[model samples]
Target chain A: MQPGEQRDEVEMLSLMLLIRRFEERASQQYQAQKIGGFCHLYIGQEAVVTGALAAVRDDDYVITAYRDHAYALARGTSADACMAELFGKETGCSRGLGGSMHFFDRKNHMYGGHAIVGAHVPLAVGMAFAIKYRGEDRVTLCFFGDGAINQGSFHEALNLAALYKLPIVFICENNLFAMGTSVKRSTSLKQIVDRAEGYDIPGEIVDGMNFREVRDKVAEIVDSIRKEAHPAFLEVRTYRYRGHSMSDPASYRTKQELEKYRLDDPITRLRAQLTREGKLTNEQFDMLDKRAKETVLAAVKFAEKSPEMPVEQVYDYVYFNGAKE
Target chain B: MREITYRQALNEALAEELERDPNVFLMGEEVAEYHGAYKVSQGLLERFGPRRIIDTPISENGFAGLGIGAAMVGLRPIIEFMTFSLSLVAFDQVVNNAPNMFLMSGGQFNVPITFRGPNGPAHQLAATHSHATENFYASVPGLKVCAPATPSDAKGLLKTAVRDDNPVLVLEAELLYSSKGMVEPPDEELLIPLGKADVKREGTDVSIICYAQTVPLALKVAAQLEEENISAEIVDLRSIKPLDEQTVFDSVAKTHRVVIVEQDHPFCGVGAEICYRIQKNIFDALDAQILRVSQEDVPMPYNERLEKAVLPNADKLVTAVKQVCYA
Candidate 1:
């Protein structure tokens, strides 16, 4: 491997490890009742977000659906703040107002972790429209599940984005399941990327389990979007090891199916690739794993120590800059 | 001052705001090439060019969410809904996304968007087309609901709605769009601040409070009441959400009898809130029981006579006023 490729592999590996450790810790917290509301973990699907975000620029915007812990962390939000948000503490990224489903960091240009199924797609399109309207070269990266592709909002947003020739990259994390129902049952078109052709936009399907492939393809796509000022769609085929949410027992899927996806574990595969290439020693891999655990534990401690939002302030923030009165 | 139609006043407001602020743009179905569904945005496309005056697909959810997204990044978007009844299709975008973004994001984002369109019953457009959406939008915490009753108020209030930082819903009456009234020049800084009620015509015997299309009904009823020697007061509630409670209470304190006339149904409507507030604050000041004249609680019929019967009119307001005044 080239020196530059080695560096990219290491960075991608670290992000995947961090997201895996953080999600595992969050799962434990959810079981312990420390975290409430819908907690959707991004355990097996870490490569999709970590790799796609690798192509994002500092000024560009990122928005996604409820499975957002990894997205927020990858966008440079501190793990402590993200964990605190899960704990509903005042120091959280959303100041405890938005729990697991909604995490917003404007400084990082991470628009939000929107909860409504397919709602934020148009919002991302709007942001891209603003960028193009103002003659800026920035692009917005919008992520949603395969289920969202069937929504009218998804189609409408894609049509608008393509018609206006706005700069945007729509990444569909096709996890094969929309909550408990498989994509085949929910969507008539099995392949999510195929639907993009209806809107006259370029579409591609990527191996979401491979971080290197995701990183390279997304980087190329984002660069093209910036140059051409047009929209594109990517269908990243991935899976989730855990259930849809904290309360879900995942009764519909078989344990054998879960075990099969475990074989294609993104982090494990990346670690092996680095080790075989002689770019990372076992000792270094162990240290990285150890550090990831430590970081997650520290984030837990910070969230536990953080104060709850005051009950009286619940009414605040309904409007910004005050309502016209 | 000059006389202008309510449609012209709205067109002038959009034109003036588009010229004043480079960040301001208009987007909706038929707003550009079609000159707006109601021609309220007439001639804007020729003046502002295509970039500023954009026509969107008939996807309310998409365009409404896009408008909110634009507002987040320092652009003020005026989203027209064709008619507010069509806004229901994009209700999630307006109620869930636009309003909650500011609070849910902890004030990092403020959605400065104005959703304007003709609202309430007009002619015999039937059930799906006509809707009194002011009460529905006013019930939301983050949205500001405004319904202008006249050409002047339409011009002034729309300017404020476009300039305000919060998400404002300007529900213009379809029936009043062609009605002419005196308005200040387009270039004149004629912004009527929101949350201030206008006493269209003042008297002492009874107070007939209304907004939007009902304001005209109240005015007509007041004239008839004057002929009957019943001094009736007409109050046009320009702003519905940040309702001018002080102005309403002051008028009620003097008149001692209140009758709320609204195009919306009576159950939990804007008038219901007004009735509650007045009775709660100054219940002892009332000499007669508070009453309300509202559209019948049924889907609007297609027939003209049935539609007219379902809607509130001057004759209904006159009867409501007489009942309150004991005349």
Candidate 2:
């Protein structure tokens, strides 16, 4: 491996570990009743977000559906704020107004973690439209699950993005199952990328399990979109280790299937690849794991120490000029 | 001031806002190449270029969400639904996404978008086409719903809607598009504020409150009542959501009776809210129980005479006013 490639792989492994640890802690918090509402962990889908986000510009906007804790962290949102948001605290990214489902950081150009499935797809296209209208070269990376492809919004968004040639990268994290229903049971076409062909936009499927593969494919696609000022679709094939949400028992899939994917864990595979290249030793891997755990624990402390949003301020932030207040 | 059609006034508003702010652009099906479905955006494409005056596909959900996204990123997008009935396809984007984004994002993002189009009962455009959606949109907290009646108000309020920091829904009347009224010159820049009501015709015996397509009916009823020496007042509710409740209550206090005229059906409609607010705030001031003249509860029919029968008109408002006056 080239020196830069080796360094990139190491950084990717570190972020994947951080995301995995963060989500594991989130799952625990949800079970402990510290986190309320629907908690959809991104434990198994870390490589997709981490790899895709690594290829985009810092100013480029990012929007995704409910399962977005990992995406938020990958897009530069601090773990503390994300944790505080999950805790519904005043110091949260959404000021406690949005919990788990909606996470927004304007400074980092992370538009939001929209709760509604496939709803924010058009918004991503619009952001791309604005970028092109303003003559800016920035592209928007919109993430959705395999399930969102079935929504009319996904088709409409793709049509407009292709029609106007908006600079957008639509990344579908096809984790095999959407919520509880497997893609095979719900979608007529098993391949999500095939839907993009109808819109006449370039689309391809990448192995979402491999961090290097996802990162390289996304970088190439995003680079082309930036140059051509058009939208592209990517279907990242990956798996989720956890259930759809904290409340789900995941009875649909068998233990063997879960174990199969566990072996193909993105973090484990990346760590092994780095180790084989001598870029990371066993001590280094242990240190990275220890560091991620420390970061997650610190985030938990921050969230616990964070005060609850005052009851009186519940109606705040409803409008820009304080119309409601 | 010069007499111009309501369509021209709306077109002027779009052209003026586009000229004032480089970030402002118009997007909708037929808004550009076709010069708008109702010619409300006529000549805008030629002036602003294709980039600024975008012509989208028949994808309401797609474009509406796209406009919201653009608004979040700092561009002011004017999303024209051919009619609000068509906006239903993109209702999730309008109702859930646009309005809730600012609050949900902790005020990190403000969607400064305007969704404007010909709305309410018009001619024989039956069932699916004729939808008076003021009540539906106005019920939402974050959205600012405007139903302008006159050409001047159409021009002024639309300009304000484009400039407002929040998502504003400009519900125009299809029937009132060609209705002529005096509007200020483009350089004068007339801008009517939202959430304020205009007493079109002031009187004492009774008040005829209405908006959008029903405003003309109320005005005609007021004129007809003047002949009978009843002295009726006409309150045009330009802004529906942040309703001018004070004006409504003041009119009720003076007249002691009110008859709400709305194009929408009576149940939980704009008239229903007006009636409830009047009773809640100025109950003692009312000398007679308030009455409401609204469209019959049925799907709009394709037959012209039947369509007219289903809608509330000047004669209906006049009769409603007389019943309230006990004449």
Candidate 3:
């Protein structure tokens, strides 16, 4: 398919599969202590990031929570920097200042993988506010988990964004749980989108596990947001296959329940659909799978070879000042 | 040059900045409609309209985080907390996000935002509403903290802060808002250098070091002591983060006596840093022990008498100066 072609279903499928395989490999590495400190994997929720990211332009800003490897990869952070960041090496996106929870690429307009639950939401609002205030037509895509919706900053940002009519697309990936607690246990309102009505902004629920659904919904809303210069909210209902971090013993949810949700694995479902529609051959699928494996391996190798930041470099990037220390 | 209240100078600076730069705007509770609770934003809504001068909900953390986020995208936002006391609700945004964003983003973003408004004890507003946040904010590396004492410094420092490339905390004195001083009208292009001290008064007997409201009190005390044949030099530390200790120490070295006055409680106050640096650098130069006159170590009281007693007022400052000079 031509790169300019209106996002081919096969390409969407390939992107989802790539994110899945990359995360699977990272999960293993994290378990082995190769990827240290607060690793939140996006295993079951690949479709939301993959689909939503595909719908937006490169100029649009994308920021999300700590469960952000998939979102970062989808937004064009190189596999090399992504894996290196997970390794806490100097070559990482944040120069090893932010390990897994704070991935950032300013040039690419990917703001952060902010660790604080609802902190980045306001940042997204501010970025969109800047775009509108400057008379520029740009959108800021802010993604957060279900738990973030309950935070005071989230409501405050949403209210300000709504009041100013800032161009922003707020994507809430409601993956059932925040760390260990379920959304139902945490929030009185089961559907997080219901909270948006309090701000007088439009809100909708998307089957986050479905690539086409997320892509179509996001594309429709993003296009309108660009035209209207206002904010929109989308709650992508999804799930996570692994524990909150790397050290969990799979105690949050039952294996049977996990297996039930795994039936709709975004990557497998997309791959099967692409083959059925003749958009991709089994051989092409195999080649893509092989390419993904090689890419992950190369990233691991690059990170392994990368030098650790010197003791002096520990405080180097603490401030942007020109001093080495 | 015009003589205006410190509040008016800040208002003028904000209005001029908004007109000069399209990227500059103001956000805070009662900033737009109520013409600013303290009237610092008076007539701004009528002048710049609703788009630039925004009134926010009583949500400091939200608006503060919004200001940080907006700054990251190249918009210079001036976020006002009605008082420094309310800013504790937004402390995480100030310390965590505002400072960490630039470094965490690998220089891809700059938080060119100013979180300003009156800081320090204000009348009998009680414990929750009275606070000195210079030390709290200065402890963070990615931030630039300024506590301007005079109307001129407030206007100049605010203008510089708005145009700075980093997140700046402008600690305005609530009491100084009504104080009149000579201020040059807004020079949008002019930038006052940060991290410098202003020698408000020159003397040879002892050095009275302070900033914000305490500087004025120190200066008044210096004047009263002048009749007693004692001279006191006054150093108003304009910025706290990149502390201007040289100017302070130079005075101390010349005078051989030092007295530090601050509006905050003595424990871990902004004066503590000045004392530490003074002891470390000019221990032998001091003829008398460095004396610090600060607020009493108690939650700011609501009663006027208690509030006055708790704060470092002219009386406390004068007493400290006399002790330092006679010791």
Quick one: best lDDT, which candidate? 1
Which tens-of-lDDT digit does each residue in A1-325 have in candidate 3? 1211276776666667677788888988987889887888888898898788778787888889998888778777888888988898888887777888988887677889899999888888888888888788778889999989989999999999998899998899998888889887999995889988999889999999888788889888987887888889999988888888887766968889899889988877777777787788889888877888888889889988887778885555555554221
What TM-score goes with each of the models? Answer: 0.98, 0.97, 0.96
Instruction: Give the alpha carbon lDDT tens digit for every residue of B63-144 in model 1.
Output: 9999999898889999999999999999999999999998787677889999999999899999999789988999999999
Ranking of all predicted structures according to TM-score, beginning with the best and ending with the worst: 1, 2, 3
Computed on alpha carbons, the lDDT of every model, listed in order, comes to: 0.90, 0.89, 0.85
Give me the runs in candidate 2 sitting further than 4 Å from their true place.
A1-8, A322-325
- Model 1, global lDDT: 0.90
Q: What is the C-alpha RMSD of each candidate to the true structure, in Å?
A: 2.2, 2.1, 2.2
Between candidates 2 and 3, the one scoring higher on TM-score is 2
Q: Is the docking of candidate 2 incorrect, acceptable, medium or high quality?
A: medium
lDDT of 3 by residue, B1-327 (tens): 778899988887788788889889999999999998899999999999988999998889988998888888778899999988889999889999998887776556667888998899887788888888888888888889999988888888888888887888898999899999988755534456788998999999998888998877888888888988898898898898789989988988899998898887788888898999999998999888888998899988899988887888787777877787773
DockQ (C-alpha based) per candidate is: 0.60, 0.67, 0.57
Clashes of 2: 0
Count of residue pairs whose backbone atoms collide, per candidate: 0, 0, 0
TM-score of chain B of each: 0.99, 0.99, 0.96
Give the interface RMSD values of the models in order. Answer: 3.1, 2.5, 2.9
lDDT tens digits by residue: candidate 2, B4-113: 99999999999999999999999999999999999998899889899899998899999999999999988999999999999999999999999999889877898899
Worst 10 residues of 3 chain A by lDDT: A316-325
Q: Which stretches of candidate 1 lie over 4 Å from their true place?
A: A1-7, A322-325
